[model samples]
Target: MRPTLFLICPVLLFLGLSYLLPFLGIVQLSFTDPQPGLAQYRHVLSDPLTLAVIWRTLRLCIIVTVVSVGCAYIITLLWVRGTPVIRLLTELCIMIPFWISVLSRAFGWLSLLSNRGLINTWLKDAGLIDASIQMTRNEFAVVVGMAHYLIPFAVFPLATAMRNVDERVLTAADGMGASRLRIFWQIFLPMTGNGIIGATLLVFVFSIGFYVTPALLGGGQSVLLAELIYLWIFQMPQWGMAAALSVVMMIAVGGILVALMRRNAETAK
Candidate 1:
């Protein structure tokens, strides 16, 4: 084998053994019943609750990706357009968020958004809120937590893409009397938009699979599909049911990922 192919094959083999084999096992389990049939899949698909949970999961994933990418876009722009000191500070802040455990961050958020927590307490003292705002354990809190967790992923792609953009081109457009928004929409955004989409898809995939942030922030009520799957697999040990849900979610993610990759390819040209 060529040296480079030899180097890559072992990594590929490892991934196939670890991720692929487990996934295939899940798929096989999804096809089984208490006696071995497609009952598990039919039951999973026929249920409205499963559909709702799946829809809610997708909705949260989309919202989280949008929020994360929006933040990333602003941060990237500031990093690209601002002073060296400002750029350094923003980059440092983005990295700092990643240094802490996500669970720790989620816990901190609970305090900030809780009624007795900082925001509500401050608001109460100011007479702004009649009661403590209960943001913890709701859909709002889940989206917020997921967005916060995914922000670094979004920023990494957008920042790298933005950095690679030739400023001289934008400067030239500006010199030619293009407006700021036009430069962004027609030039800057479009240029980096592929990377943004890739980041969004990546974040969305991760967010849909997320359990900890949602469990911590969503308070066990607004249970995402990931939580549902986790319950079935680990807590309940209903391997067939869990496998059914996992197969569906993984298929959905795979389709979205294919679309994302194709879009990225077109954007590359």
Candidate 2:
């Protein structure tokens, strides 16, 4: 017991100093404004710009979560049902995109989606549109960029869950005259329910706090919470406001984790 406690104490101390200490300080800063109180949290509730950014952030997160997870689910199904060689090749293809730095990925999208981009060039040649379509510096670009980074993340949790699903059960059902659709609905989906929930939670949490992808893709237009916090601190030097924004982000992500864990626990039964 003494040895175990000694081992845990240092880890606990480190967490306290790193995460807990800074968080508590921020909470204190949020309250003790120019003076001290609940003003900072109130600002979170009342400020129009903050509210708008938070709302847009939430909207983007929901759409990204749905699209990315759905895409991953389909890809994972194909992976699980494929031959070993096919699976290996597919995974290699997916991981190739994953290995590239995110910044580079965003830039790649820029080349594809810009006004004079490859897509527009092809479209113009094919008479799809009379002029080059502008896809950069807007909500469209933000979602595209975010979804690119998020898809791989969505794939792993979902594939792990899908992989763990008992294939024999589905096979047995098919042998007994069940249709593929029914078998997938009845057996496959339920077994992987926890993974779906987990992946959605993980993706949503990351999406809400995402900065780089949206910052580059959306320009300054589609400002999310993380970028808002960054703007407050670096661009505007609003330290007090920045600390308050940071606390809000922490709380929001923590809330996502709590919901994810609760759903997971319920599914365990």
Candidate 3:
């Protein structure tokens, strides 16, 4: 036990320095800036634009999480059902995007969704539409980019959970004449709820902190919390306000994690 604890010490220290230090610094700044009061936080709460940004962030993250999780679930299920070669191909496809830089992916989406993009160009050549349809710089584009980024995150957790489910149980259900839908609904979903929840949280949390995709694809219309935070620091030079908003975002994510943990604990009990 002592050896194990000693071995873990380095990891713990790394986490403290890397994560805890920055978090504490943000907390300190949020309070200390502008003479050490809750004024920054008050401003964050009172400002209508800030509130709208928060709402938009929540809405976008929720949409991204749902779509990513649903798509990942389907992919994972298909992976389970497929032959070894197919599974290997599918996993390769999934992992390939992750190896590529996120900025590259976002830029790729930009090219695809822009008015003079490949799709619009091809459509115009084919005479599908007289005018280029607006695709980029909108909520739809933001969600698509975010969901594409998050789907891999959702896939791994869900696949792990699904893989852990007993093949014998599925066979038994089939032998007992259970329909495919019934088997999935009754056995698979209940057993995999933890994975689904984990994927949801992972995707949602990451989506909330998205900066590049929304900035590039969202334009003026679909501003999110992360863009607002960036604006406060670099553009507006509102350090106090930025720190306060960061604290709020941290608390919101932390609260969600805590709630999920507590619910899981209760369920375990």
Candidates 1 and 3 compared by TM-score, better number:
3
Which sequence of candidate numbers ranks them by lDDT, best first?
3, 1, 2
Q: Compared to the true structure, candidate 1 yields what TM-score?
A: 0.95
Candidate-wise lDDT, in order: 0.86, 0.85, 0.90
Which regions of candidate 2 deviate over 4 angstroms? 1-13
Candidate 1: segments with Cα more than 4 A from true spot = none
- Model 2 weakest lDDT span, ten residues long: 31-40
Q: Residue 12: error of model 1 in Å?
A: 0.8
Instruction: Give per-residue CA lDDT, model 3, range 1-269, as digits (tens).
Output: 99999999999999999999998999999998876899999999999999999988988888898999999998887787788998988888788988988889889998998999999999999999899999999999999998898899899889888989988999999999999999999998988888898888888889889999898888878999988999989998988899999999999999988998788778757
* Tens-place lDDT digits, model 2, residues 1-269: 99999999999999999989888988887777666777777787789999998889989889988988888787776777788988987788678887899889888898899888999999999998997787989999998888878877877888888878777888899999999889888888989998898789888888887888898888888899889888877888766777887888788778878977987897797
Task: State TM-scores per candidate.
Answer: 0.95, 0.91, 0.96
lDDT winner between 1 and 3, please give it.
Answer: 3
Candidate scoring better on TM-score of 1 and 2: 1
